[model samples]
Target chain A: MEAFLKYFDLLELSQEAGIEDVRKNYDYLKNLYSGDSIEIAALNTDFSPELRQEYLARLDDAHEKLTQLLENKKPAVAQNTVRMDDELCDWIANIACFSGAALKSIRERMVVDLKDMFTTTRIQLQYLEDIENEVFESFRAEVYLRSYLVEYTRFLSLDTPRVLADYLPRYRAWAASRTTPAGMPHL
Target chain B: MIWAIGGGKGGTGKSFITSSMGTYLAQKGRKTILLDADLGGANLHTFFGLTRPRYSLTDFFDKKVALQDISVQSGIANLDLITGSIGSLDSESINHGQKQKLFRHIRALDADHIIIDLGAGTHINTLDTFLLADRMIVVTAPEVTALENMYHFIKSAYFRKLKFIFKAYDLTTSIQETWKNRATYDIHNLKDLIIHLKQSSDRVRDIFDREMSGFVVHIVLNQVRTPRDILVGENLKSVCMNFLGLPVVYAGYARFDEAVLKNINSKEPFMLSNRLSPVATEIKALAENIIAGTHISVRKDVANGSLS
Candidate 1:
């Protein structure tokens, strides 16, 4: 739990607050403090100007952080016991190296280089992990993962859907295989 | 939440906005019910492609059917519609007792939202129904007459709310006299009346304060063709805030898409028709803003007046 999760409590919401909740609370708070109407002024007559400004800024920060959380949230995807085909896995492993861009001898140096590039593009470290670890299951839906991959590829100058077109089939096959008795035949 | 959609003028796209908004909210998984409270002109049924509803509110009134029993599937997911029909007993001319009965039945509805598509003009029934809604959206177009009607509707509602609140106290006589004096003097705005009331007893002032605080009016502009049309909503919000002395939220606008006209003709909802269309996108955005309760052009003030 980060320190900012308390902002949810400040807005009288749980940690799992929906987008609607964030919006409603933010709207209400904004109206309550925006200081432009006579009715609300009649209602809250005690708060000084400085106090109102401070409170409004805090609320804006809280609302902004919560919205960012909603945007960056990784959906709860099923991961345990899901396995991928080795042929698809090997292909993904090759793409994971970004067509030899990450194929450098110094592994730590690659992480540092990639981090700077990701920072420039505002892509997350977890997204990079999701792409590199082919054997691991995605903690988000396929659509979101594919879109993130588009941005990820764009950040690395792969800037095309080739990775998505290749990776999604195997991802679907892996997802489908998990539902089978002996984890059905390979794609 | 109960929503009443009405405009002072006719052909300002009340029914179209109602059905589209209902469809949009329903598509978002709300258990939405659209009631054609437009008794005299019960045309909400036509917008959904139905010539007439199999079970209109007539069944509820004449046959004594339950309100729930009269609700029919609107074919939109999670949406049920109660059709209004032109019968011997008119919606516009519903008596006080009948209005009370309908109000009770509407309150008893178990859905997440009851969207009442009110008839045009500010009749007693229309005003009462519009006032009772938890959320009210006044639909208007970009024309002068439409905007004037919207203002008239808000003014009527403002007085209606005062009447309803003052009814509880024995202040009806004084309130009536004050209202009569205002009418005689042509002092139509509530500011002078509110100031006059504050100088009276504390109870009337307290009731006025509480009622004014709770009475939030929302606006949505329909049939917008250009950016100028879209700007009508914000402009209206300013006028209402400054003139009407009531809080107003400009809940965005829907464009005048030709597809929307075709959809109305074909009985296809805008949500299901070309969701990628600009109008559909605006409707969706409208739904988002409504549910989110954001994009309020007028900010609420917390300043206490001399009385408080």
Candidate 2:
């Protein structure tokens, strides 16, 4: 974000000066930074003729626009500039001071992505919650039913014939735990 | 819209219902993908009678193959299967990176409804996948073990999702922190806590209301032994509403029929073996009601390429 703001400042400075001043300033800055090495490989890189020309044209257009804005070449002004209301002026000032167009664009994109991420995640969370709810409820029911089974064991023990193994501590533990038994034990 | 089928406990028939639903949708001419997301025990393929999946989720995760390549075209028209790599690589082993990768593939897939058969339990991976789906169908039996697991699953998932949403709006407060502390059972009951949150952040209440409104937690009870088992569904609905302040609509109860067992033994969905079987019929009816209730139009999504 800071890097984007720095580039934006340079762009704004270019727009404020005349095209000639912008061109000269660009060269001055470029030379002052000549201590930095230029990549010969970048200039020598192969690109299709049409692509190269189009890229160059874009660079030139960007430079030209910045110079014109910097020069403040006043003619018939476009409606892009207006006497904004106090509220609007304050809003725009806040936005300009606190934001860069490039950064704003990035933030907009990020907001959309975040919204999508959260939306999908929220649904997943609901599913998890449902599973938890169901599982806990099942455990509750198991607790309830297993106790009932214990009561039933005592009920049947008094009245009729019943297998003691069915009422064994291991069976009770297994019933209480509700954990699935392991696959058929290795031979 | 994607609907994840999961139960808190393993072996409560999450894959069974998911695969059967996939089969039913295929028979109805809707393109469907049954994602075997159970990285632990990816046996959904076995339920389909496929001895060996040509490409499993393991291949995709390992970068040995693309997701599309791993997607096996089922014999049933318009149905696709993404086999899970269970025994070889357990579902619990996948970290956040792997889980995100799996979800990305699931979101990009073309299907009318991507029914994710989530791995059992409420680990971060499973919960994350569950949260990513558009809707969720929690399946459980009448047994107590299944109900308890399901309850905890819902509570954790809801808390995690709410925390994410509140944090998104930059409205983190003490209430949010209190909610995360699962120790306090009464946090779900405290109106004062919500009022405190709302006072600190106005949007908190709105976010909570919106999530509570759009959220659909459908409960489906499988393997009912008696009519009394049916009350378990109602009991769950009441608990959700009373305790968590979330609306839970009962999806339906599937009877414990020998046919479900037969399908398992035969390596076929009961719906395929006998569509008219009591349990299969119940499942089909439940599926229909769910689709209708959710207002998911297979035709509309197909037309828009949202579902293909």
Candidate 3:
């Protein structure tokens, strides 16, 4: 993985790099570290907790070096750098690989969460649509019924012919109650 | 499974066959939903002596009731009828969207068998509804014109089904370029075209094979005038094989019986009035054949993880 990065000059760690460049460099480092870790873990199934802790610490140290490079524009402690220590380098490489594993897990979880959110929102929308349709149907039926009632009332309130007569006790009570009457009284 | 009875020409006995089968199924104690999917010219109610349908397909569409609630029990007992718009339905009234609504409602209807009596035509709406069924029964008389119309109807349906299957596999553009071209439609044998399509996609091959193997392109020859009319069913079966290379089932024939005409004129179901008539007897026999055929398919479906 590191060899793959070496082929791409754009991926190299730099002093004047932006956050995106730092992120990209960190990703490459993490990928190389995690790949080595997976290989070591596959071989040494009975690895000790101490060995694991040592490898994890080395990984954290590499990330810190990248972070420091981004923040202060200088690499971490050059005088203290154990350039001849092959074991330390291997441990650091394993840590970066482990970071890649962690990033992969984080991305998978984000995808699942996004899917769940979309499904939940879709169900909510369908529920709202069903309620809306029900409301609309009720409003339409109500309007029809109201119009029917108005027409029925008008039909009932129409005056009767003179022969059949609209006159009844209620009509006479209304006539007496009125201030004036224009028509001739019927016996 | 639902069967949507439809084709391009009117007065082709879609209503007659649908009602006869529904009645026969009811008598045999199989619960059937005789759905009226004909939105434009719904007359299934009149065939069953219903002057006014209290509840209709419109009620389901308008959301006044669930599809189940609107199903009126036919006096035949086990069969239920859901009429399409009896009075207010116009051709322009039922749009594409409403037809989809009607289809969805038809699917949700609970019954042992569902038979949809669709309106006549190769109208886009009619074609879509016909293809939506689990099985398609193309009803044609022994007349020259009816046979010609049925031929074109089957071709259109076959093309549409192929088009749909190709679209699903994301091979629509390729299929359209290959087949929709002037040279391809001119080919007499659809089987040859299917063979060509099989070379391109296995999914297309499976769809074609499935349609051919499961159902036998069941044909019902109505209004058979003479003994020679019986030969029409056999002739149609041969044409289907030679042209489409599909096994065709001559389910049975409904002869030109004066009784059927009388019942139709009187606005009564033939099965209700005269079950002993030749046409009624033929229909009952046809219904039995259909039930037997469907049961076999149902067993296969159960084996394939499909259950009621």
lDDT: which candidate is best? 1
Q: Please compute and give the TM-score of the first chain of candidate 2 against the native first chain.
A: 0.22
TM-score of chain B of each: 0.89, 0.87, 0.85
lDDT tens readout by residue for model 1, B1-308: 88888878888888888888888888878899999988887888777777868998888877889898899888777888898886545654667887888899999999988899988899878999998898877888877667767777888888888777777766789877888888664454576677677766676667677667768777788887755455556655544554456778888787777787788888777678677887777777776676666663422332233211
Q: Where does the lowest 10-residue lDDT sum fall in candidate 3 chain B?
A: B295-304
- Residue B215 displacement in candidate 1 (angstroms): 0.7
Please give the C-alpha DockQ score of model 1: 0.01
Q: Identify the superior model by DockQ, candidate 1 or candidate 3.
A: 1
Per-model DockQ against the true two-chain complex: 0.01, 0.01, 0.00
Off by over 4 Å in 2: A1-187, B176-201, B294-308
Model 1 Cα displacement at A81 (Å)? 76
User: Can you write out model 3's per-residue Cα lDDT over B169-270, one digit (the tens) per residue?
Assistant: 687787657766638455324565666776556666666566545545567777777554565565455346533555667777777777777787898878
What candidate 1 gets wrong by more than 4 Å, as runs, is A1-187, B87-89, B176-188, B199-201, B296-308
lDDT of 3 by residue, A83-164 (tens): 3246533443343222223322332333323223223222233322322232222222222222222222122221112211
Clashing pairs in 1: A37-B301, A40-B301, A40-B302, A41-B301, A41-B302, A41-B303, A42-B303
